[model samples]
Target: MLYPNGWFAVCLSSSLKPGRLRTVAFMGNELLVYRTRSGRVRVIEPHCPHLGAHFGYGGKVDGENLVCPFHGLVFGPNGVCIGAGRSRTPPRAKLDEWLVQERAGAVLVWRHNKGKAPDWEVPDSNMAGFSAAQEACFELKGYSYYGPENTADATHFMQVHHLTDVAMSHEIRQHQMEVNLTASWFGWQIKVRMINYGVGCAYAESELPAWGLFMKSYSFGTPIAPLKWTYTLLDSTHVRWLDALPRVLRWPPQALVGALMHWLTVKEIRKDFRIWNHRRHVNDPKLMQGEMHIAAFRRWMMQFYLRD
Candidate 1:
């Protein structure tokens, strides 16, 4: 069973077609999804409870409700039985309502025994920052724990892709600050100034949380157990390199920075993608104890995975 106690991405927002149903597996169960005539989204048991017929392949939306193709049974978005087969006997009040929400241009469904929604809000990223944002899906030939662990494994940032001057090298010694607790914040800012091994030095803050490795990230897995990831690059170096470099370059201002930054970032990302593709579900010395980001990110992950 997938998403045993959390939300999982099922499909991109563009996959849902009006009046057409799609069967998806979540929380170890099959859910039938379809858009109503009024464009409302609905989820229900994939098989018709009356006779075990697949609902997704032949289902239709009637007004704001979803109707079974086999028996013409109708269900509301709340999973209430609004009507069945033209019978006015008042539908049963015992239907189950599934939890579904949209985040990062994708539609997610939560399957749980408690049937509750998450209180945390997904960050609203400035989608226009990237020079290009393309959606493509790839398979992970391994287990989820490995994928989660990769987010904190920074040593590879340099070794695997030959990326130098990453965030890991900006170590702050004798800079002791206690971890702060917060109830919640729809937005946040992080500030840090340090002498680093990168091109000169800079100060930056981002809305995305620093989780071991990935800040702004997205991933999903099916109940059948394969996982996939679609990474979006924000502000590529080719797009902002020269401005990012601490000192003015010796060449044309825009020409040097934009072209150089984008080229380097794209080259590094392609290398990382190749490394990521070959790593299925292997456990390695990806991280060690006392690593700065792992513990914090694990806690954050738990908050999302275990929240009622």
Candidate 2:
């Protein structure tokens, strides 16, 4: 499948501090990500238009501009070259800037095969409770579309995760899909509400009212190469009464609870990773009656892909 065009996370917001630069690979392209002294984040093609030097390796942030290490060339956040050592700015001397958004403690960049502007924006980071402390990344051999599409595959809850009494319903909107799932996990009833915005980003919020536990998780997948992609998962957990308890007494137990929840979520994804890593894409899937949404999801996903 062609890479889906949308906003896809590249790294955690915490990873890039002010006046810092980092290199990241996304959608089969190398990008230089940096934060200006003013605290604005920028994503641009890594190669310097002056002499083809990779800026990500030794790029320096000068106030709000990026300076190339190779020849001291400077470029602004808009990617236009200002000058190099009092020299005149050359025509067409600029880097390609990508549309970037920092949300939910993650850095997301918009990607279009033909450089088209993003049609929709990522959801507000404040919509759910997410913390940078609880996050994990995994490298997997699979298409970038698999993770978000799997969220609507209702049958997988019982077959893959071993959850019982599984029930799921979904509604598709202009730029997002909402899925609600109710199931029994180890005798505890859990309800999960997930919203997939395009194929690159999805957020799932899970609640266990009986246990006073609440979790918000975000999943992002970006293509690194053909049949290869990187998947990142981040989640934050809160215990109901713990928040009201005395700080001194609640610290240890709350930490333990959050850690356990994070571990369990990772374990569940690892199980799915195994299946996705080795499976082949079946264009004409022999799905059962209950698997109608799987086909519908595929049709929706195709809209994000560019045609020749």
Candidate 3:
């Protein structure tokens, strides 16, 4: 199984400024991701269509076009070679384009075997009400589909995340999964609700009613190559009482909680990296009755891959 056919995040939206270009590794190949002068992100094949120079090396963004390093050929947002050096007129060449979109402050590219068009769209959340995302990225030694399966495994949370008195339930809808849970952590009763979108992305919200604190987190896992992937997490917190406080005092507490949430979340997820980095997936797993959801999740994931 190579990288499965689905949407995988390529990079952070904030990383690509206007007229910035980057060489990104995605789905076992190299892609050129660039933002135009007007701030539109485009993902394309990394080579100059005419001479075959990799754009990641010396590629430059000219206004709304991407300039080739070799012959200064220009490619527009549609990946068409619209400008060639000198007065020879643009050649009948075009760079290949990939389906990409920005959501929750990250760029997601839809990938499929044999270049098939995407069948579904990723759902959006209400991020406008939250603060700016506190982010972290990790280069993991393991592959993905592993990240999403964790939602169904409860025993590991107790051993890995150190949970106490946890109850969880799930609602599945084809490519999407909603998980709601109530847990007791260090005497605080917390409620968490998460939406897992395909194998690549997850959006989660944590609520502390007594403290009037709400936290949101977006997680993405992107495959860089075989048996390796990149994991990114962005977290933000909103304190309900902040709005009642003075303007000067409103944001500080919220920002402080956001920062702390980011730190603690990152710390907890790092514990799983130790296991995920070294674990292997077995086609036929030995499962207990309590782990039935893990098996169901694996069955659900098969739809994301191309079939024979």
lDDT of each: 0.46, 0.84, 0.84
Q: Where does model 3 exceed 4 Å of error? A: none
For model 1, the stretches where C-alpha displacement exceeds 4 angstroms are 1-4, 86-94, 112-116, 128-132, 169-290, 295-308
lDDT of each residue in 1-308, candidate 1, tens digit only = 12334455566666787776787654335677777777666666677666666777777777777667776777676666667776756445434556667655556565544666555333334533232322434344333333343444455544764434445322322211122212112233222222111110111222223321111223343333445333323231123333355444522544444354445545655665666657653323265654655554443334334435
Per-model TM-score on C-alpha atoms: 0.60, 0.93, 0.96
Candidate 2: regions farther than 4 A off = 86-92, 125-133, 247-252
The deviation in Å at residue 108 for candidate 3 is 0.7
Top TM-score hit: 3
**Prediction 2 TM-score vs. true:** 0.93
